[model samples]
Target: MIRAVGAAIGVVLAIVLASAAWVAVVSSGRVHDVADAPDAPVVIVLGSQVRDGKPMKFLSGRLDAAIEVYDSGRAQAILVSGDAHGRSGNEIAAMTEYLVDAGVDRDKIVGDDYGLDTFDTCARASDTFGVSKALIVSQGLHVSRAVALCRDAGIDAHGIDAECECNWLAVVRNYAREWLARPKAVLDLLSGRPPAVVTPPDGTLTAVSRG
Candidate 1:
């Protein structure tokens, strides 16, 4: 009986800790424009899963929002960060294609296919490319975490409101999952090499240069 009681307590503690970690970084005020403030070398587009090189609905939403921000003169350049596990299955590539389709200049889009995870993506931006201040585009629920992660990595970052919660159920589920993801993000800051500047190679997402 005592063992069972201890197990239950452990479970509850884990959940509580996760929830607190998530709440510590979230805020309704984080949604803002990175443009018209200061010039940032790059705008890091966070990764989301793709389907056969195509963006899933959620992923598309982020791309669409980022495109709008791009069009509005918010940022001069875009960096698509995502998994490049497959030669053809690349989220950043899909995102670049989407942006180009929406009339964004091809030269402004940069792809960072090495960002396999959120922390890696942000760190790569700060360390790999010398991005100090950047606008992270994602769903409202996710932007806070992105901003927090960027700050943790010693980069000045802010979030722009890119996703809406039309479906409360999905939003709640994302929030729930984020609770646990926050701690891992914290750990990422504690581990890794120092930041370094990397210049992005020039290439269009679907083979067309905006220039």
Candidate 2:
């Protein structure tokens, strides 16, 4: 019995390693610096924690990157995806307010309040928002997984690493979280689970001016 359990553990560990490797391989050459990122119809800013109606540090970095993309004209619209029902405050509202305060046109922004996770964000962008091609913005440790998941969800997706002032300890913690999350992301793709909330394409994204 001990030998059988040990062998099963080995198999699980191998599978986890393989999944992480797959994400890295598939996302190679797809993550670019802000200057090199390709133009796309929209830039998707994945959500993070909100504090007192403002984005926390990591999420602020993501918003800042999206702002840069918007200013460069590489993306015509911005999609802020996050949980509206967050315990602290409404993440979607906070994200939108941040962008508007940064001078992005309110009309050019759309909100997905049910983007509860990375996979759900990608899936909803494809199915509910009618986004075909997009640049995903996230922190360095998380952007590759976001890019891979978005691509698997049928978006012609690329990624930009958001800048953050993270301490070494925070960085290490985030990397550990990412390592464990990759296998779950792989399972999510293979399982083909639909997002928790599904709505018809509301034409909001399509209506944004591309010029």
Candidate 3:
């Protein structure tokens, strides 16, 4: 029994190691510096948590990066993908307002309010929004998985590392979460799971242009 338990433990460790290595290998060179990727036309800003209708620091970093990319002409349109009306309120509303307040034109901002997760955001970007290629914006720790999932969803996707100002503890937590998340992200791609919200063919569920 003890030997069997030890074998099971070894298998678990091996799986973790393999998963981590897979992410590292697959993600290398897929994320570029925002300043260097001036040709990317559309950017997808993945969602993070919002508190009191304000973006948390990481989310702010993503928004800032997207704004910078847009202003620099690296991207013409910015898609803010997040929960529309979740328990924490409307992430897309907050994201859109933040961008508009920061000088991004309301007409140029497309809000994907149903992007409840990274997978959903990527899937909907292509299937619903009709986006063929995009730059993803998120913290460095999370960009790899974001890019991978987006590519799997049929969008020619790359990522730009967001400017993260998170504390050490938060950074550690983010990395830890990502290690687990990477595996799940790959599985989600292989499984071809449907998005939580599907846009109607009549274009009724189109991206919200606050303009």
Candidate 4:
């Protein structure tokens, strides 16, 4: 019985992993660059690690891509979404600062401090921020999942790759993580779990507030 149980568990794990791999395969090529991304009113700049109040290389690349899209007139506004659990440690703050410093209008950026993950950001973008469509910015491995989540959240969305060549480790790590994440995303959508945060949609907040 013990050997049988172990074999069954192994089989289950293999099936799960295989399903995840399929998800990633089908989800690739969904993320596009600024010139190729479909038009949208807002670009959701997905958050990443920050250090010393600055965006790390990966996060910086995402901001740069979003800014490019905005400058190119592909989008009118940007929503920087990420975890902001503690007062002193906020990814959105760093993202906002980076964008503004990069010459993006301060008023053109909005911060979603409660977006703890891709799903949270997408849900809030639709339910709270009233974002009907958006271009998501993140690494190639990540943008596909982001596109899937945002679409699940009722937003028409596309993804733009933000992965930096300098962060090869990030590429490997994110791809591994995404393998698991893609499968989980499908389950989460099916389970109908609500996001961590939501606010009544604010129309003006959806617009360029500071510019």
Q: Which candidate number has the best lDDT?
A: 2
Residue 59 displacement (Å), model 3: 0.2
TM-scores of the models, in the given order? 0.75, 0.95, 0.89, 0.86
Candidate 1, backbone clash total: 2
The lDDT values for all models are: 0.68, 0.92, 0.81, 0.80
Candidates ranked by lDDT: 2, 3, 4, 1
Candidate 1, residue 144: how far the Cα is off, in Å: 0.8
Candidate 2 — number of clashing residue pairs?
A: 0
List candidate 4 segments past 4 Å from native. Answer: 1-29, 86-88, 209-211
- Candidate 4: lDDT over CA atoms? 0.80
Q: How big is the RMSD of model 1?
A: 5.2
Worst 10-residue stretch by lDDT in candidate 3? 202-211
lDDT of 4 by residue, 129-208 (tens): 88888899988667878887888788888889774856677678877887777667777777888887666676754657
In order of TM-score, best first, we have: 2, 3, 4, 1
What lDDT tens digits, residue by residue, belong to model 2 across residues 1-211?
Answer: 9999999999988988998899888899999888789999999999998899999888999999999999998899999999999887899999999999999999999999999999999999999988889999998759999999999999999999988886888788889989889999998898989998887777888789454
**Model 1 poorest 10 in a row by lDDT:** 202-211
lDDT of 3: 0.81
Which model, 1 or 2, shows the larger lDDT?
A: 2
